[model samples]
Target chain A: MKLPRRRPASPKKTAVGGSPEATRAALLQAATAVFVASGYEQARVRDIAERAGANVAAINYHFGSKEALYLEVLRRQASERIERYPLPDPAQSATPEAALQAALTMLLSRLLADDQRGFVPKLLMRELLAPSAALPAMVQDVIAPQFRQLSAVVTALLGPRADAATIQRCTFSLVSQCMFYLFARPLVQTLAPQTYDDGAVARLSAHIAQFSLGALRAQRELLERADA
Target chain B: MKLPRRRPASPKKTAVGGSPEATRAALLQAATAVFVASGYEQARVRDIAERAGANVAAINYHFGSKEALYLEVLRRQASERIERYPLPDPAQSATPEAALQAALTMLLSRLLADDQRGFVPKLLMRELLAPSAALPAMVQDVIAPQFRQLSAVVTALLGPRADAATIQRCTFSLVSQCMFYLFARPLVQTLAPQTYDDGAVARLSAHIAQFSLGALRAQRELLERADA
Candidate 1:
């Protein structure tokens, strides 16, 4: 039986070269498409090999197993986006507020800007809803580090007044606000009905930054008042 | 072909009386389980009928068509939750702050409180990610009205300074904050590792209320300062 096809055929063609590197690259690309279309478990290794025009033996030779291939796909997809939209180094921004805004802008760009054709965001979202065995590795390798980076920024913004838990919750708030755009895109489109054109990421980034910074500042004040 | 079963058999037994009303209720319950498991298009009327202990012809006799049955499931689920967690009557609170807090608390309760076994929340989350034909009607019947109600509360809180678009965006911010806990539950669980016990809803509601109210107040102050 033909598996149900959800995504359009990828325009990217596997390289014709019979070299090992070329075959491996083709396998990764094919695996990504199959994984995105069929999810991790339903994705068949045979189908991926057929799509890549590679031998079944090539998969095990290159990646050892389907699980390893999936992990590689996730790691590569996540790293590529992070490299493209890296948060600014701490010293780059003049102030914590500036740093926070830059971080939100980059984070929004990462989450919403390239979401069309993006695989990691979709995979991670699926992982959130019905987590697979890969979730712990993902949280460890990707999510935890991102959380710590955001936590640092929240700490700087909230200053010494807020405790660790407060910082953590505020970090969740900031990330959640940004993610809502991607996860709830359909509802957002229906309600707002605007062109999510090139300017959308920057525009949304501004709104989130303004709202979040204001909240962080307010939280700090409340904590200060309580201390007094 | 044996269909993959995702959910355990619902404890709700079809009424033995074989009355039309009883049959319809049973179908709704079975359809909710099937729809939630297989989604809209893949869900089979035959399976739903068997699960409900009714005849396949009974579905058409009661609800007219599969499309109608699906819509009825969505409608009933949405309305039940709304009725249970209706937004504050506008006059119920003396201050907009109190009103907004009450609204947030109720909204959070609605979104997060009964979500564990709730069919509607699961179905709605599916709608957000992979929208089906019923999306427009669900948006029109359920989402639009909810947006308007939230808009009213945001308008009252933002005072006269913020415009319609600002009010709309702020409303999205408020809602996105509450929904994050639901959509991102696994991530929240992985990072926090705490039991989402009974108190989780009220605690999360308090955090969102504080963060959002603070943002709205700050937004108003910014606009007021600009006017100065």
Candidate 2:
């Protein structure tokens, strides 16, 4: 949830850089919204401050500059979302299917989460679609590791004998299915509104898992046939 | 290919409304470039004119207004791209697997064709991510029909016993795999540059086809087991 809007630092407060943590939190929230809506190239510092109900001086004092503020927003949102729906360790599950399902459940829940107008995925997706200086670090720090973990889970499902290309395609296929749900939410909402109801995401996730396991089983058959 | 830039109305030619068909084509081409790069709201009419090497009046003359021009660009690009890589009729294929593969081959080819910066898919994706007035008509006229055809192919592969939900998820899984390549191209390029090389897409497409087939077969086994 948004911190109380407009918690501007008062001069009566401690010296510069002494703004309450709430004000700092508020600024990051507003920056995510502004950047997602207008993009980095077009977003203005004053607009972020206005939306946050904080003053430009507060932004300057806390984050140092607009670019610094944008990076902070990216880092904060990524860390928070990852925190909220943390990936389950495969060891926590009994089977690869269960592990994969757990990973997907966390992912779908994050993508479908509309809390704070879905600021987390929106800001992250905007960066992916339209990159900024922040993107390299974002990919390296957040995305790459998330992908590697998912890749490991996928490879586990495919078993040790699966070739690299086969593993890569299977991994990509599963991720793409999940990404489609997030990336095409607007279109899907119009096309299939019922998909968003209570427990609907879990149902959808179940279907994708079944769909994928089915495909993997079939692919294993083909590989076996080729080997024979 | 982009029409010659800035083919202004020659004074030696006819009067205002007498803009040639070539000019109209150029306007449509230029409009797509501008719209994709800047989006509909931020796109400027004057910018399209400069790119087309035509005057602003030529836009009004050929397409009536900015909204009209945008619509024309959407329609023209959709029609041309569809024309370039037309979907095959299912009747021509001998089996469901072949039919499904044919459909996916066309779809992925269209998505991966980077000629002209892969303009068609990029423009259409930008619209889908950020839909406008043109989106509904675009979906109705262009997208919905394509989906329906693909759905039919998927349903056939699913067999007559498959229910609507099963068929829908299967269809979506197949499409999501292809759409992922188009949508997350930048990320994929960074992550797996090998995927973009000659024959690489064909290999990817073959993997998706096998993956879907595997999943479908596995799903069938589940259904049979449940029945037993």
Candidate 3:
């Protein structure tokens, strides 16, 4: 489906002219569209402002600079969206398969529900491809913490005997499974010629969960084999 | 480390100075760098020619159009690179673990070693991220055939008992393990704080092989459980 065309920002006013916060919100939304369309390096503040229907100066007033605005856009879109997917409560589930399923479901739902035209993942993917000076801050403040929390959940599920490399690979596999749909969607669609509808999504989720559980189970086996 | 900047293309002496074939090769190489840097949508033939040290007219003379040049780059760089990583000989071994390990080693080596300023994977990643009109031809000519061949190897290693989904997931896991490293190297470096030197490469290879074997073993167990 084609995304909505970019619209010029209206002056700071919601019908009767809303608050500055409203204007700021509008500007951020516009920034998301512009960034997704042109990528961070190519996105211009002027276009973003125009799309928001706010004055060009509004971006400076609200976000301080284009870079700051971009960072804020990422913070709002990527981090906040991820936060919506609450981590699985450990007290409720003791089984590794249950915890793994919960985590996989949360991840798949988040990836699938994100409807912004290439807003979240594309931004992150771009940063991954050609990192900028600001990457350390982004990684530290946003991404790393989430992954660490994920690792904790996974560790709890796998119990005390899991080795570091095993944990790392499992973590990589989980993230990679979710990302495959996003990063490889075009290629998959081209090759598979199947629409990834709800049915397809269900099938994919089940496959990923099973694949992950099996990997974890096998890790235990390998550990036991090593010991023997 | 920063990659070496593009060298100016020497002037054409004869059809052989760059014979028409030499001219074509130089153009494609230059086009690869430009495509990698700017992506297909934004890359210009003039820039490619300048990068290759040839006149803008040379592109028209050689490839006929910008799109043709782009396709040529994909064929030469992406498709040919895939071709280079030939399927592991089936007679070499039979165990699923050994077969997978051999295939993964070949895949990872090709992926990591070909990271010449992100030429090959970057191009493929771009196509994956945003498919263009030329994608079908690209996929048919370059990507699909290789994937099919790889899939057949995976299917054989998996034995006759594994169903289609299991085969697919295993194939996905193998590719994910290999591609994720190149795709997420920046994040990996940031989080791991370890150099991806020879030792790290060995560790990573071991990690992928073990992880993959674990997944395959898990798949077998799941199939058994289901059957029971």
Most accurate candidate by TM-score: 2
Interface RMSD of each: 2.0, 1.9, 2.1
Off by over 4 Å in 3: A1-27, A41-72, A157-161, A193-195, A199-203, B1-24, B42-46, B115-118, B153-161, B193-195, B199-205
Model 1 per-residue lDDT tens digits across residues A1-228: 553232333233444255667789889989999887667766899999988978888999999999999989888887787677666787788999988888888777777765436677777777776677878887786677778878999999898878988898899999998889988888898877793667998888899899888888899999999999
TM-score for each predicted model, relative to the true structure: 0.81, 0.84, 0.79
Best by DockQ: 2
Instruction: Output the lDDT of residue A170, model 3.
Output: 74
Clashing pairs in 2: A6-A53, A214-B214, A214-B215, A215-B214, A215-B215, A218-B214, B6-B52, B6-B53, B7-B53
Q: Candidate 1 vs candidate 2: which has greater DockQ?
A: 2
lDDT measured at residue A201 in model 2 versus the true structure, 0 to 100: 68
Calculate model 2's interface RMSD in Å.
1.9
Docking class of 1: acceptable
- Candidate number with the higher DockQ (2 or 3): 2
Q: In terms of TM-score, which candidate is stronger, 1 or 3?
A: 1
Tens digits of per-residue lDDT for model 1 on B1-228? Answer: 544322434234454244566678889989988997777766899999988888899899999999899989888888887787776776788988887778778777777776536666677787876677877877786667767878898898888888888898888898888888888888888888672677987788788889888898999998789888
Task: Assess each model's interface with DockQ, reporting 2 decimals per model.
Answer: 0.47, 0.59, 0.53
What tens digits encode model 2's per-residue C-alpha lDDT throughout A49-90?
Answer: 877767789899988989888877766677777777776787
